[model samples]
Target: MKVLQINSTVNSGSTGRIAEDIGHFLLQQGHESYVAYGHGNRPSSSRLFKVGNEWDRRMHGLKSRLFDHHGLGSVKATKNFIRQVEVLQPDLIHLHNIHGYYMNIHGLFEFLGAAGIPVVWTLHDCWPFTGHCTYFDRYACDKWQQECHHCPNIHGYPQSWLIDNSRSNYRVKNQIFNAVRVMTIVTPSQWLANHVKQSFLKTYPVEVIHNGVNTDVFKPLDAPGAGGRYALNAQNYVLGVANVWDTRKGLGDFIRLRGKLDASIALLLVGLTRQQTDGLPKGITGVPRTESVEDLASLYAGAGAFVNPTYIDNFPTTNLEALACGTPVVTYNTGGSPEAVEKGVGYVVEKGDVDGLALAVRRVLVQGAAFRVNCRLKAENFYDKNDRLQDYLALYKRLCAVASHQTVYDGLQN
Candidate 1:
């Protein structure tokens, strides 16, 4: 079988890695796998295709900034990509994060509507349904459930400096997205699937497939030196990590939690910008993002507890990584963050509850060795990378089978 996966990036961030893992799984199963990406170059085991040039990305960004027309620009890029798709004639097309200043959504969907190819779209965020924002929970906006007009998150990601074209964007998406005849939506968490059912895209089937982590790479490490390198004790530090630390990721909440934490315990944050690290308060130690998975695993293993206070998110992979590394997690009860924390594995506190976060960290510290076994067990049982990759492969086979049956039935009818 030939499978083509399209995403914003290759083997990079969470979504990119998911795409890469799925590609690798297909290749291992003796199937042809191809990955077409729009941003970032990363090593992958599958055939690689670059969707558009840097100039196209720049023009798309500019269009989004001036007109609030993200996903609608890059018309030529989308046309070129569609031509490539025709040549490949893939048995299946799997989509992920297609809105990162890359392909034109209208042209892509129009082709899908006519081509009669099966599509599986894994929504990493709320961007596909909403007109403006990738996430609406932070602002308590329900405009996406009806019609998006005068978007509250106009200044957020895919930010627009000039226009408010959300109403039209919503209408266009509502029309084009539903036009596809053979498509399925996948969300990493049930929280997101429920929201998809509420949106205009409710007509299509939705599946919840939680993101997974590589236990072999993320499992507990015996690096005794990991603590000394960060000036933290082996089991006396509270850790937080993100690809980028910002207000949404709860950088400020960590700063506030520092005051409530005991002086003996240390606070460490990974994935901070140089400026962010420099501006951090005295008690919190900030480290820039590390590309080495080994280094990240060691940090997770050494921590007493992992805290994720994100205000808006859909199933963060960090929580699974921490659990895989035998570190208990303490996360805000926001979106799908709490879903990773099964009972006895971690604690879930309300968003912005710094006091509750600090208390949970203290409890983890006290429980210490007790939670480690449960954390690791939870990860191995439910969040293992191989198991989740197999899930995708199973879905692909089922979808292709259904498509094949429908084609045969149509032929018989004719």
Candidate 2:
């Protein structure tokens, strides 16, 4: 079977790596796998297809910023990609993060609807259904249920400064997206699945597949020098990590939590910009993002507890990574962040509760290495990369088999 996966990146961020992992799994099962990506030059095991050029993305961004028409740009790029897809004739198409200023959604979905290819779309966020923002919980907006207009998050991601075209965008998306006949929607969190069921896309089947982590690389490390490498005092620190740091990620809450914590318990925040790191308050160590998974594992292993104060997320892989490293996690009760923490493994505090976060971190620090075994067990049982990848392979086989049977049945009827 041939499977083509389309995403915004390849072998890079969480979603990119997931596409790579699934491609690798398919190849191992003796299936041809291809990845078509819009950005990032990361090497992948699967056959690679570059979707669009930088200029295409720039134009798309300009269109979005000026006209609030994000997915409508890149018409030529989408048409060219459609030609390539027709030539490949893959048995299935898997979609991820298609809103990343690359593909023209109208053209792409029109092709999908006409071609009648089996599709399994993994929604990494709510952008596909919503008109403006990838997430709307922060603003407490529910307009996506019926219609999206006068978007509250108009200035958010896929940011539009000049116009609010959400009403028309929503109607157009509803018409185009629902045109596809054979499709399944997969969300990384049940919270997101519930939201999907409430949206216009509720007619399609929705599945919850929590994101997984590489346990072998993320497991407990014996690196004693890890502390000194990051200028950490010892294993007496609470760690916070994010791909990008901002107020939405609860960066300010971490700053407040530091004052409530004991001076002996150091605070280390990873994945900060150099400028952000330099401007950090005292008693908090800021480290820039590290590409090496081993380095992250070392940091996770050496820390007493992992804290994620994010106000918005969809089953963050950081929580699983920390658990795989035998480090307990304390996260906010926002989105699927708390789902990674099982009882006795960690704690889930209410969102923006600096005192609650501090108390949870202190509790974990007091318990020390005692929670390590439980944390590792939880990760292995629920978030193992191998198991999760296999789930995708199984889904692929089922979808392809059904499609093949339907094709045969149609031939018989004719």
Candidate 3:
């Protein structure tokens, strides 16, 4: 069977790693799989569409969805892709965060639905069902519940001056998505799966498939040098990672907890600007982001506990990484993040429970050595890399079977 996977990006971070993992796994299994989307133009046995080097051009390409819900752009580009896909002729189309700057959503999904193809949409966020926002909780708005007339984040990323473009997006997406025969929704956590049920996309079957981490690169490290490199003794630190200072990720809550921490403790953060670092309280240290998985694994092993003060999350990779490195986690009870922490792995505090977070940190850092082992055990039980990948493979096959069976039934009735 042939498979086509689409995502906005396949590089730079965990999202990329995820796309790569699935593609490589399928390749080894002797199944033909290809990837589509921007930022991953690498010559894989599976890359169906190779986008050019122009970032702005790639972004502008997505605007074609607004023109007509049936295939974006001139016949030339659409024909080229359609021709390529015809040659590949995949049995299944798996989507992951396809809104970035990759292939045309309206064009591609419309085609897939019309062909009565099976579709497995692995939602990394709540983008597919919503009008526009990838993450609306950051804006604290619920216009998505009705119609997205006046968007709260118009001036934000993927800016649109036109009002109610969300309504159009919703219309186009619904028209196309409804035509899909087998739409399997895959969320990273049960918390997100539950949220999917509340959205306009509740019709499709939803499954929780926790993202897995490669433990070979993320296992516990014995080097005390990483501790000194970050200016700490063994087990003398805490770590946090995020793309930016998003309110939903709860940066402010972490800052408040930082203020109450002991002067001896240091909160090291990656993926923040110098200004963000300077704005942090006296004891918190800011480390530049490391793109290497091995480096991050060492960072986790060196830290006492990974602290996630995020107000909301689907399922944070930091929680998994900390556990993979034999480090505990202290995260909020909001969203699916707390579910990942589970029992014996770490502490789960209510949103803004700075006191509880700080206490969890001290317990793991100064005295909870045995408790940290529980974190590693939890990773093996729930997030083992092989198990997570296998789940996707099974889901893909199941979706394909359902899609095929539906096609035969409809053909017979006609």
Summing lDDT over every window of 10 consecutive residues in candidate 2, give the lowest-scoring window.
221-230
**Reference-based lDDT, residue 11, model 1:** 90
Q: Residue 185 CA error for candidate 2 (Å)?
A: 0.9
The TM-score obtained by model 1 is 0.97
Which scores better on lDDT, 1 or 3? 1
What digit string (tens of lDDT, one per residue) describes model 3 on residues 1-414?
A: 788887666544667678778888899888987887656444454555653345544545445333322123333444456667777778988888766544566667667767777888888876676666666776777766665555676544454545436677766665666677678889998877877788777888898899998877777877763656767766777888886665767778777878778877878887778778778777777766666777778888888778999875678887898898888888987667887776677889887778988888887776557867787888888888878999999988888888788878989999
**Two-way lDDT contest, 1 vs 2, winner:** 1
- Clashing residue pairs in candidate 2 are none
lDDT of 2: 0.90
Compared to the true structure, candidate 3 yields what TM-score? 0.87
After superposition on all C-alphas, the RMSD of every candidate to the true structure, in Å, is 1.2, 1.2, 3.5
Error of 3 at 94 (Å): 0.9
Q: Write the per-residue lDDT of candidate 1 for residues 1-414, one digit (tens) a residue.
A: 899999999998888889988988888999999999998978999999898999999999999999999999989989998999999999899999999998999999999898878899999999999998999998899999999999988999989997999999999999999998888999999999999999999999999888999899998877653656977999789999999888999999999999998888899999998999999888788898877778888899999999999999999999999999999999999898888897889999999899999899999999979999999999999999999888888888898998899899999999
lDDT value for model 1: 0.91
**Tens digits of per-residue lDDT for model 2, 114-218:** 988999999988898888889999999999999999999899898999799999999988899999878999998988999999999999999887788889889
Instruction: Supply candidate 3's per-residue lDDT for 353.
Output: 77
